[model samples]
Target chain A: MATTLTREQQRQNTPDRPKPGGRPGAVGGHRNWLAGVAGWLWLVVVVVPIYWIVITSFKEQSSYYITNPFAPPAEPTLGNYGMVIEAGFIGYFVNSLIVTLGAVIPAVLVAFMASYAIVRSRTGWFLRSVNSLFLMGLAIPLQATIIPVYLIIIRLHLYDSLLGMILPSIAFAIPLSVLVLSNFIRDVPKELFESMRMDGATEWATLWRLAFPLTRPAVVTVAIYNALTIWNGFLLPLILTQSPEKRTLPLALWAFQGQYSVNVPAILASVVLTTLPILVLYAIGRRQLLSGLTAGFGK
Target chain B: MSPTATPTTARGSRNGGLAWLAVPALVFFVAFGVVPLVGVLALSFTTWDGIGDINVTGLTSWQAVLSDPGLPHALWVTFLVMALSWAVQTPASLLLGVFLANSQRYRAVLAVVYFVPLLLSSAAIAITYKALLDPNFGLGAGLGIDLLVQDWLGVPELAFGVVIFVVSWQFIPFHSLIYQAGVRQIPKSMYEAAELDGAGRVRQFFSITLPQLKYTVITSSTLMVVGSLTFFDLIFVLTEGGPGDTTRVLALDMYKRGFQANLMGPASVIAVILVLVGLVLALILRRLGGRDATHSQMEGA
Candidate 1:
């Protein structure tokens, strides 16, 4: 499958002009072959582990041990997935869903409003300071602040609850969200905003009716970006929550390791089930996720 | 509507009204980010368990962190990972980026293939690799390769190397994506002109691509440094800094002190040092990048 794709790509990649036969031409040809080989090598290195996980997820415990690990399962079964689901995988999934949505929605919405204000209120020292504040937040690693965060959560009586995770996650996410959203908002034409003002629209009205719609791409970008981060978060849940029931997917996966030790197939089956939602999300929003991640660095 | 009745008034009122719109975000940032950060810094100077009354002991925790026996080893391991990641991941990604950029067809599919590991959770990647590298029934033994079967995670010498390889695998795609974006920004005319001048692929890459990617390389390097220093979840899950603490990094050290040992003060000290290292590295890289940009600009002139 991969070879056919590469062959078609090579056909399309043929240059318009014929090459001059010389030392440089020979070297160029050698480099192209090297590139092709490296490309295929990288494809294999990436695909094999993912392929292993999916295939292993389908094998029963006995077959997983008996069959060739690299081969397709001879007795493919849904038993591993059923065991995972029976072990409360759905509960963890719902917990992850609630926390992710609870955090990302408020973070993005607040960031959009804040970003709009930052870009539009050009002359205010307060807004300028706020922008700088967010930039400074980029340097503060969350690991460094976990100690105080735990204490604060305990003080607020929110420790061991999803709200504890959601609040701090939202807080940490705001800085980057505002940074990206503000950059996107600044690209909107000044005339569009001015015209909206000329039509006697209040600033709030213009924000919803004009700026919101125009910056939809940035909104989606920040939304998916934060959702991915919060969804896969481990440290927050590990530190903040203790109950077996409150465990998010990543923490649940960790817990499963100890409980099902030596049960490789069942453990891997849980791993596959836990990651399926995020993989689906990535497939849907990959372009935005990629562009958003690299967007800040590009500047 | 009148033809813009005093544009300044409209602008002034709008600005004033909207300036307050940032208040909610500001509150969150200050309460969660700013306060906690400041709290951690202050707490580093004191001895306080989560339950006990705080006692300020000036410079004690700092002194302990500086002299702690385990810290130096953890720092060494972290530095090893950082150096290895830069040595291995960066150039590989750059080459992959160059190849992908030149490949016209199947670009989207190929990129998605490369990015799959990155999209999955760190815990998931760690578990997947753990199973794949399992000494008994893993892919190694299953494939019947004699040399492939080994206790990868159990051996102290090999455990750190395995962790580094996994970390590199997960992040290489990200660096490649960045380089791909950088490669796309290079104007095609330059490459075409080089080809016209009989410059081979190697020379063109050295003269055109490398020079154009200087800023990107620096930015990515800084990110790699900071990321390696603070990386926790994957390493924690994979080894828990196990097999005689061979793979322990600074973050894990902090986790142990704060949570397991209940040494909050010392943990705070490690946290402070980690943040300082990140900030100093970022500033240095920025300064270096700034100088290079100006130098190149002068040469261009």
Candidate 2:
């Protein structure tokens, strides 16, 4: 905590304003009513749909059309959620969890090690090139490679399998993971590594003990970010996995929406159910998640 | 600070064992990422309906994709979405960022709420919009707001407009959060100096805020532009490239051709184009911002 505070103070001292010290400060906006209006107006735009979806998810389909869309259900029923679960959303939910965890765990572990190597052995030209390759991976729209990925999956006899999705997802998650992890890993003090080394610890041991513990927050942030992404991923499952039994939540949500085109509540319930885990996660980790996000991107 | 610095540490850290640690990530990336990157280019020249044996016929796929009017239309739609969404999101997010940067208790609450859309999957958000914008049984008909009731994803111009609006609705919060961080990062002393110079709040925003956020703008815009190219799931779930293919962006075009129609070669052509456009745009944005590798890695958004 003391070190972090000092580091933060150090960060504050070295302002990254493009114009040496020319940062806009005094934004005391008591009369900035236009922006205030815009902010609240955007709030309505964001909240109204969510509000409608929640209320609609609880309403019976028989009364859904006759009632107001924005109004709370006069006679709420749990039938929509019940129908959704009965329609196998729980299975889809489980598939999504497997894919998310399946991809994220290995991606973070492998990425953490790569980050440690890049930061530790910065002098190695080959390692530097590898880091460069990952950085270049960032600029590529890795999604565009889905066609060839599909081809590879088919050839590997892994089509229609959750593992197929997991492989490519891990590959795509790496570049950013390495960048963020390396950024955090670089912040670990050199003295700490030297002390561990002097104690006769191997690089691997020092890595797990010193680097991993110190960068645990970054590791979590990377995991959550990748998990959210993989959980919400649709295209991979859409093309790679063909069987109903293999559908992840996003693909299942799309398929479920198509199946229940007439029953809006049931579809809405599936959306809610699929997102509930993430929303619950957000509620619990809102502070850590948001700050990690802002810091990960903003830094 | 020690004058000797890190000669020992730097040399000591250059162990060969440390270099091998990057192997697993490198191997995975090469097999999946680097290989596919090259594979897309190679596949573009071949004619194979995704299930059949591989056969290469150079330049045929390119010729077909280039000659087709659909390609240009898709490109134009893509260009429109990228430009329009950037224009809309950049200003609103910048202003909203400045607004949210204030450390009021209410603002904290607002940030939490604003982030809700970011949590929801694009498929869910698109599905929600689809139901809400259903001309007959939607929010409009339910509320009797005739103005709100329209075939939002059916009509051509309106469909295009809906695409941009939905894109903005889902993404502006995220970009706004980035800008908010950018705003907070501004040194307070600069604002004090500007105040001492008698600059009003609006004037200070124009001068200090605008100029200092140059890099942040590039970072956000790069993500916005490059990210817009791959907006397949949102557009697919919402409109499936729409009533007349009016919303068929490149990503959707690639998917439809490759998976739906079994035309992998043509789709690979589109994929190659996407990679080029992404690279070119990223480089242009990077060049525009001069140079800062770390700041631009904010492209993860």
Candidate 3:
């Protein structure tokens, strides 16, 4: 049955050519089975820690102590989740949402216009300078900038506020975001822009209506990437926000760590809480996730 | 100017004016990005601790960065960690990707499992792993893998291993997807032909699949090289450059000197070197990896 399908697939793949490899009947069945098992084994190893976290999230502290760590809980409970929630997980969750979405929206929008201008504008020198700056940004690690960023925040009186975090996040996000979006926009059909201009659309309208809509994949890709970057970010929020009221998820998680050393279940529980939204987002957009990453970053 | 020429020139100038609209981004970039980068660079020259005023002395920070006992060892350890992690992750991702591409039944499920690590903040992952790797109540003891359960974050070798594992685990699925994309682009007939040739799966993978995956390999490796160099958050959260700075990469060290020590100058120098490495890696990858390297310019959303 497999040999028959292989022959049929070959005929479709290369209609004119003969088979490239050797005989058809006796294949490497044993080796194929081994490879298949090897592949599954690889996946199992990769998935174990993640599975450990999820299962541990449900297990009670006593159960976590007595039972084998690898075993499922004897009886799982929402008690850990309750502890995490009561510890004000939702406030931090909201702070994260505010920071992530707040950064993403402007980052995407401003980057769209900037990318449109950078790609379409006729002037060469300005475009070159802008491009190079963004490119250089690919290397500008946040650790290097944390002090100066801290200074700027206090100087501007934006310190410890969402705006302080949001603004810089947008700034840092631009180089990569503009790079991706502009490349994508550059792929947009020239005729589309010409037609829109002929219809008397303003430059802004042409960008928003014709170019931006077409670049949805790239835009959504940028949004998701920025959201994750902002959400998962530690140092910026750590340095910038001192007030517990304003702290993001990462900061809050750190607070949880210092406060809850022995509460293993609650810590894992918070990890579950903090990690869930993005994981769900990943699940919904997993297909696009890889493409976005490889398309933007991979050679 | 002719009327049409004048209007066109006027529009061009306006576009030029609008181009500076990137200034909001530029201002922040210069302030948050460029200013600090330059500030760090300038700071690296001085002998100042991170606190008070920087005492500007040329090459002092550079001298410290180069001659400091920890600095060179840190660099070596970094390269070792990155190399070993790449060794582990690149092949792992490629094989997993190939398997997922072939099987459809649990692809999404498996992908979610793999990608969950990417979602958590590095601090959170560090925290969770700390709990798991705990010497006492931690699962490491409970599982009887006592040998595997050293003070993973405190000892130099074990700390290095833990850091590498954490970083690699988070990004491996990402690398896998890159491989999967490359695999999908390969025409189906190649696999069938190899099968017909009595090529076993392992043989076929080498002869067919691996060769075709050159672009993905180059891209992912380049990313890994640059990424591992500046990796800070995990190291920062997990070890805080501790068990006596055993896990300090360039970025982590830079953070320690510049921010923690308030020796802005030395930190800046470290930052410059780190950025320089990033640029050099990017340029090298661009040259060696073909036109696809330019595709990264398109990466932002």
The models' CA-based lDDT, in order, is: 0.80, 0.85, 0.73
DockQ (model 3, Cα): 0.33
For residues A168-226, what per-residue lDDT tens digits would candidate 3 score against the true structure? Answer: 89888888888788778888989887776667566666677888889898888778778
TM-score of each: 0.91, 0.93, 0.87
Q: Could you tell me the lDDT of residue A255 within candidate 1? A: 88
B225 in model 3: Cα distance from truth in Å? 0.8
Q: Give me the overall lDDT of model 3.
A: 0.73
TM-score of 3: 0.87
RMSD of each: 5.6, 6.4, 5.3
Residue-level lDDT tens digits of model 3 in B1-301? 1112112346666466457546566666677778777766666677765335557799977887787887787677677767888898887777766655543335446665665566667888888888888887677777978686778777877887888888877778777766655565556667667768888766887887787777777767877777788677787878887788677788787777766777766777777777776667777887787754545332221
TM-score of chain A of each: 0.87, 0.89, 0.85
lDDT of 2 at A163: 94
**Worst ten-residue run, lDDT, model 3 chain B?**
B1-10
lDDT tens string, model 2, A1-299? 44653453344444333332454422332125456777898889888888888999999988998987878999999999999899888899889989999999999999998999999875788889999999999889998999889889999999999899999999999999999999899889999998987886777888899999999988898888888888899899999988899999998899888988888888888888888998888999996677555548874
At residue B224, candidate 1 shows an lDDT of: 80
lDDT of 1 at B271: 88
Which docking band does candidate 2 fall into?
acceptable
TM-score of chain B of each: 0.89, 0.93, 0.85
Error of 3 at A202 (Å): 1.6
For model 2, the superposed segments whose C-alpha errors exceed 4 Å read A1-31, A292-295, B1-14, B292-294, B298-301
Sort the predicted structures by lDDT, highest score first. 2, 1, 3
Q: Over the stretch B1-301, how does candidate 2's per-residue lDDT look in tens digits?
A: 2122233345644456677788899988998999999999999999989898978999999999999999999999999999999999999998888777655556668878888888888999999889889888788988899888888888899988988999999899888988877777767777669878987767977888888888788888888998999999999999999888899999999999998899899999999999999999987887898875445746433
